[model samples]
Target: MERLLINIKISVNEKIYLKDPESSDLGKRILKHSIELIHSIGFECFNFKKLGKEIGSNESSIYRYFENKHKLLLYLTSWYWGWLEYKLVFSTNGISNPKNQLIKAIEIICDVIREDSRFSHINEVKLSKILIAEYSKSYLTKEVDDENKEGYFSIYKRLIIRIKEMIGQVNPKYQYPASLASSIVEGALHQHFLREHFPLITDCSDTKTTTSFYSDLVLKTIQK
Candidate 1:
């Protein structure tokens, strides 16, 4: 039965790490608690020293995995996109219709997130909240070009490319598949932020309604 079972792992790029956190127990603890700490306190106030204290380890020990808190943010955001791509693939697999696949993709991206035990160290639900509130900070920096060169945002770009390709299949004449795909993803993130902080700005009163609006938006835009 062990051989019949499968394990899912979200791989972050090697250049983002000094040491692979998934390779060791201490590393996993650092990652798990770092997510908790950052989500609880917000990234601007989060640091290795604080993370170390929460994980019952030294700041130097945490440094073994990530160079700085910003890199840690990159790793977290990278891991999220990687995992989301996996979900997109799994969720839409074997579907014959491009429109249906696109609808599934939109629902997957827009719906409220849930934690998966397959990644024991990561809480995807909390990570989704982080993505809505803090994902921009991952790349909005002076070193963005440098980090892009290292492929830090490659997973996110690939996710867009996948969705964009689906858009092309549904509407081969559409001139802005890339732009539309990115807008959908970013718009969903913004809506999530607004729903949480300023509910009046969004049409969604709940996740179900929120998901419906995105589903309708994708279908309407592409069919137009």
Candidate 2:
């Protein structure tokens, strides 16, 4: 950083870090441009030099926030998951019935993917692979790979357990545990939104259709 800025006689302003991160407005802007650029061309091909040139910033600016390409992708992927956790928490409150909760979870996931183009199978598959691969190492740094692991997982677990209990209520002789039901539910939703089921349903562009289909399918599948 010092070497690159030295040629232009630019000095590091400690106020940016020592004072307020908001002071690094240029750095923040560069990060935004970096996200846009990577989203367009993909993280594999996005070039900070080009991004800086297009955004009217220096290459050093992007590098200031992100050390390299890998770090940039990590930040972008993490940001998407962070937004997902928020939507999940907001979407499934006051709906405590296990059946309703499970349906709501699928519905909310579909609605979220509809709103974010990056939530497509391409990004979903990529992010899944990345998360699975990094989960061991990332969890070592904290309790989970994603930042809001406990907050989201607790509600999610409760919802799943409740759903399985509801299923058992309908079919008292069912042998499998609720945790297995949760796995099935999560897996089904993931397949639908992130795979072949998506392209077949163009009407699902709206949240209504998305949630409706998800809810109907979930209810039907869980019905005894």
Candidate 3:
């Protein structure tokens, strides 16, 4: 799987960046350090100037890649989704059982991220942390509708649809496949956040527990 992933390029929407960050060494540095900085300080306090200082690049150079921090967040989130989609597809590709496929998909999305050596510059672990804490800020804005129209959230929506189809295969007559699919995706993230910050309220203490919770919920909810 690492060999396959090393050859794959996680593509994000071209519209999200002024220049493709993956296209240059400096741009990749921007993405790498930005993830570290945001994970360390939180996105609310992150800025290009800070990122630039961390990467030892000029602020203007960072702007050459991303127009602003919000767009950078969008790019990061979109890239994460794209990378995850590949994992889901590859991991479940030959599984003929619908229920098994769905379980694997849930596990992939809900599992705690480990460092992927294929992409050395960008830390998948830190990026996952950012996604858990800062993903909503990427879309919950006044321009979200406009951004949606431009397909800013296409990869994420596509992932939900993939899960929705798996749900339908599991229970063809299920009335709320789409809702269940979306809930599983978003709910996993929320549950992870709760586990990390408010452990008393969430029973999920780790990745195994969280994956088990969502997999059980999904199977029960879609059972015929």
User: Which candidate wins on lDDT?
Assistant: 3
Would you list the C-alpha lDDT of every candidate in the order shown? 0.88, 0.50, 0.92
In model 2, which range of ten residues has the least summed lDDT?
A: 9-18
Stretches of candidate 2 above 4 Å error?
A: 1-23, 112-213
Candidate 2 lDDT:
0.50
TM-score list, all predictions? 0.96, 0.50, 0.97
lDDT of 1 by residue, 120-189 (tens): 8999999889899899999999999998998889999999999999999999999899999998888889
Q: Name the runs in model 3 displaced over 4 angstroms.
A: none
* Deviation from native of the Cα of residue 220 in model 1, angstroms: 1.2
Q: TM-score order of candidates, best first? A: 3, 1, 2
